[model samples]
Target: MSENHTSTASTPSAPRKKHRNLAQGVVADISEQIQNEILKPGDKLPTESEIMRIQGVSRTVVREAISHMQAAKLVETRHGIGTFVLEPPPAQAFGIDPDTVITMRDVLAILELRISLETEAAYLAASRRNEQQLQELRAALDALLNHTPEDGDAISPDVHFHLLIAQTSGNRYFYDILHQLGTNIIPRSRINAAKMTHDDPAAYLERVNHEHEDIFNAILREDPEAARAAMRTHLSNSRERLRRIQESNEIKSSSDNTRQ
Candidate 1:
């Protein structure tokens, strides 16, 4: 009698993009390009081949990122032509158009959006998240905490942690919009503002992570009210952090002018 033997070796897969920067990472990279005026409105975006080369992500990843940018009104594609940066139309009302988020004030405006949406998301996540998702959230947070300076900022895992919470909310809109905002939603990722403002950036990050812990614990205990409160506190603190940075910069500039 012949017996079938199971293979002990796992099937090998293609090497992942370093750190799995993925579609969101591509969005962030291209968004930064737009923010810095490297690719101005009406300018044609680089071809997929070029984007793939620059971002070290796959062509499919590039396409996915571009789709999100289109959803955000940051870019437009003409079939058989190419994608182009969009000139934002005049705001008909007071609402954020993510493309216009170039200044610190703009960032604060979007952070307000995050505060409103994510607070509710946390409450829902606490009430609805499954055991597997809870484990994923914990894993994402731990990755952020353990991320090394050598691999660059903790933005990837930081974004992942929040994305997981939104995913756990069981509402696709929350996940979709947050994914559309991507890393651009994070102030530190947007401007590296923390490093410039905080006397000790490490300590500041530790404090932020402490707040994350509070939120995580609330969800772990299935305390919806506490989860909402914890999210509010963390996001509110981010706003205050930015305000303080702005004030400190202004004061320093005034001092320099006086000395001169």
Candidate 2:
């Protein structure tokens, strides 16, 4: 031990610290460009090599920078495609980080958020959706209907159906929030609560599809009031199912804690 020496310059932590600084430098430059509108919303960021050249950073640093940008919500990276700048959230924008919505309670909170946001969206969609959008909605509906109940992975159609409603609502903010939320908005996708709570998950999903059909028919009829009512009932049914599961969980947790 008396003869041992470890050089800080060669330590792994030293290289990591250097890389973090370089990454932060890249993140700052790109963030400034976005804030200044130099990199506007929907505009794709440069290739990773381009960024490496411009920032004089390593590939690892550039990738780290992009990850930081995404975490800040300044950009969204589409796999196999480039990262694009996102429209900045407004000062009053109500946002929920999808990564944090892990628990059933978190999903229930999201349902409440949807109840307020989507009921109105459904009404607006019914009143204002064009023929093209309506057809798109039909295509989305059929996708949902065709999802084999044997598979529990129904996220794609479920998300598409709700996103179509938001897009059809003629409100960009509605679409923005829902799009930002993405597949995470579907609670069953996240937690598989239906499978846990229902004796027949397939039948539960079938009934869920029927609820979707009701909402679609209301929209097809262009009955705004009916659309709003259908949307409310659909969401309320989900809320009730989740509430039951959550209640059961709470009781079990309380019993376990008491025993402990």
Candidate 3:
């Protein structure tokens, strides 16, 4: 039995590992082509079947490669059409890495930064927002509230809601700063607060929407003091929520270890 097991283990199981490498190789090759201008922006990539035939890879490998490219923002897929190379955006002067944010302290620090910047933005937006801008702000808030956590499309609207406020401030700098921060401004990017609040995901989202409503109403009222106060409260509450999640996770981990 021992000799039989050794013979089976010694036999090469290279096919599965080779397929995984093929997928990664495809991604690297396509990225290099784009860099060399062989695949220009808006140029369509080969179809999945065509790629599979040409690269001698399985359909699964082709799809995995495409997914990697999309995640890197190097390409986009258009329904009824095909995947196309994308023009890279300009380099940001400063930004945070979402992957590096693993702890509640990191999230709280980001919230603190936002409180300092966005509180003033809300105040300025209250004074400077025009009628059309005010309407847009209301629309953004409505969009946010319209989606539940289950849909997984709630983050975009939430980001837009804050972005509209920055734009309304009449300071292009404020909007640029927030845009540079990208989706990291959304708390969900750093911490999956919705999933962590396992009691009721919909209720969690609704509670957040209520906070947004307060900020929106204050801005609509054109009360700078109220707007500033509301914005500050929203961010402070977010910090507390993340802290609670961190503590809960630690407790659960300890319990599991003790049981083990």
Query: Number of clashes in every candidate structure?
Result: 0, 0, 0
lDDT of prediction 3: 0.84
lDDT (Cα, tens digit) per residue for candidate 1, span 134-247: 999999889877765556756778788898999999998898888756565553434465676754667767888899999999999999999999999998998888877778
Q: How accurate is candidate 2 locally (lDDT)?
A: 0.86
Clashing pairs in 1: none
Worst lDDT 10-window in candidate 1:
1-10
Task: Please provide TM-scores, in order, for all candidate models, with all chains considered together.
Answer: 0.59, 0.62, 0.59
Put down candidate 2 lDDT per residue, 121-200, tens digits, no spaces: 99999999999999999999999999876655678788899999999999989988877665655544344766667647
lDDT per residue as tens, model 3, 1-260:
99999888867776768877999999999999999999999999999999999888899999999999999999999989999999987887676777786667777777778888899999999988899999899888888878876576666787888889999999988888776564764546544776675646777777788899999999888999999999999878777777788789789999999999
lDDT for each candidate structure:
0.83, 0.86, 0.84
Q: Please estimate how well model 1 matches the true structure, expressed as its whole-model Cα lDDT.
A: 0.83
Candidate 3 lDDT for residue 256: 100
- Candidate number of the best lDDT: 2
| Residue 258, model 3: Cα distance from true site in angstroms | 5.0
Model 2 residue 248 lDDT score: 89
| TM-score for candidate 3 | 0.59
Name the regions of candidate 2 deviating beyond 4 angstroms: 1-94, 185-191
